[model samples]
Target: MMQSQHPPSNYQNNQQNLDDFDEVWVPNPLGQTQGPAATSGLIDIIKSGSLDSLLTNPWLVSIFVATIISVLIGAIATILAGQRSTELTPEQEAQQALLQKSQNLEQTDNNFREYLTRDDNNSGMVSNPGLLQAATLEAGARYRNRIIASLNNPQNPAYNQHEELINYNSEIEALKRINLGASGKEAQLKYVDPSTGLWVTIPIDSAELAASGLTKLNIISNSRRETTQRFDLVTVAQNIRKILSEVKAARLEALRVKGLSPVASELEKTDWFGNKASPSEAEISDYQQYKPEPIPANPNTSKQTQDKPSPKPTGGQDDK
Candidate 1:
């Protein structure tokens, strides 16, 4: 094999000669040398000229940060939506339920009002008596016949016919004294005031009729006093009737709760104990025979007994 020899330059260090060299040494055109290379791939990527490209690399740290922010925003939006939905649901449901209950209550009130307005006979009056008298002579008479019939029955142990008849007769006699006339008052005399032109009626004092100006109008009559008394009596009768009606309704409700038919007057005549009797035979004979004595006129007003003093006014000045 042939060998070549070469002269050495100033940059190169010469030990002997290039006669043993196999190839020539060439200089780099870029004038760069490879030194100790970067150990990490991440450092190499950062050193690259494209900074945005390096940051957007698939395995980069910035991508993880973006993903975490997006997830947090989504979670906050979802929580806000859920809270709003929860707040509205029960309020809407309660509003709908309240409206339905109010409608039902209104319907019930209307039905009761309609029932109160029913007038069958149309005699310009309520069909049923507003006040009914129970435990009167008429009531006793109706009950006594049942007692008499029960006395005849062999099954009934507590039958006393003569005593019951006498007691019923006495009750009839006593009830005649009560003297209930009309159920309500007639319309009063209403006058329009001359100065104010308003329709009005003033209450008058029982005493000092002349000073009250009632005597000038010829309004003082037995009929007028009787009408006023009748109003008071009717009010009392209505109160009594209300009490009786409450008692009857309570009794009926109790019977219904126990799964029993309420007692019917037409079906069977029974005492409070549910034993059957005949109610039709009892007659108020004494009641039909008795008549009340006429009320005596006031002796002081009769000219024969003129010494009595008239009643004085008991009230203070009238405001009107």
Candidate 2:
């Protein structure tokens, strides 16, 4: 009865193996799960329920580690490929640049339109004088070209307008030529006749009807010449101004395309012809201020009205 009782030999060996397994793989005391691959490997080893079996099969650990490494490498490659795909190509970059330039042109056109619509008193003059001048000339050239195109096209019905413009310009040139040399002698007036649409020249002597004892005729002829002169001058000036406004918009767009800033003096300087490249402030002001003369009452119309003998009062009610 007093003899010492020892544990069974198989039980003692199993206890020793359990102790060895705990030493080889000790889990965190906090009980938090490990990474996917590591946790899975631990699960496989634990499911075997025998440390001797795991120790005997070393190929199992090799396979788990290899799988994790391959997965990590593949993930890294995918992330790198995604990043490369996001980068822009050279052709795409060029297209973006062109789109930006087109936007600039559109913006420039809008800005110029706003500028033109402002009141003359408010927008008396621009900081850059040359801009207006360059824009004006550019606009005129464009208008002339468009008119020529219309003339060339069979579908266009602006032939009359083009003819009038050319005729008016020719008359202006002719007037300038005749007036330059006549300092002592009175300059004869050359004008386009509204009735015939032909150039008509009134001789200096005929225009001076007071000396010829024909005061009324002389006055009428002189008045016609004066009115014609003013009309032609104003028409040409107005046309140029209208054209200039358009050109200015185009010039602003061009500057934007080139990525250049406008210069204050660029348009202020004269061209090869020694003429100012743009309209002067005085000229612009004159155009803005110009008011057409009210048409004079015709003597014949007034006489007819006086003689019309108040339409013999009909028997109808005056209210009706």
Over the stretch 34-149, how does candidate 1's per-residue lDDT look in tens digits? Answer: 34332244565566666885666666667678899999999999999999877767668667655655555556545444443332332232233322211122233444455557
RMSD of each: 28.7, 23.3
Worst 10 residues of 2 by lDDT: 222-231
Of candidate 1, the 10-residue stretch with the lowest lDDT total is 215-224
* Residue 62's lDDT in candidate 1: 70
- C-alpha lDDT score of every prediction, in listed order: 0.41, 0.47
Candidate 2 Cα outliers beyond 4 Å, as residue runs: 1-17, 22-98, 107-251, 255-320
Misplaced by over 4 Å in model 1 are 1-88, 121-320
| TM-score to true structure, per model | 0.16, 0.22
Work out candidate 1's RMSD over C-alphas.
28.7
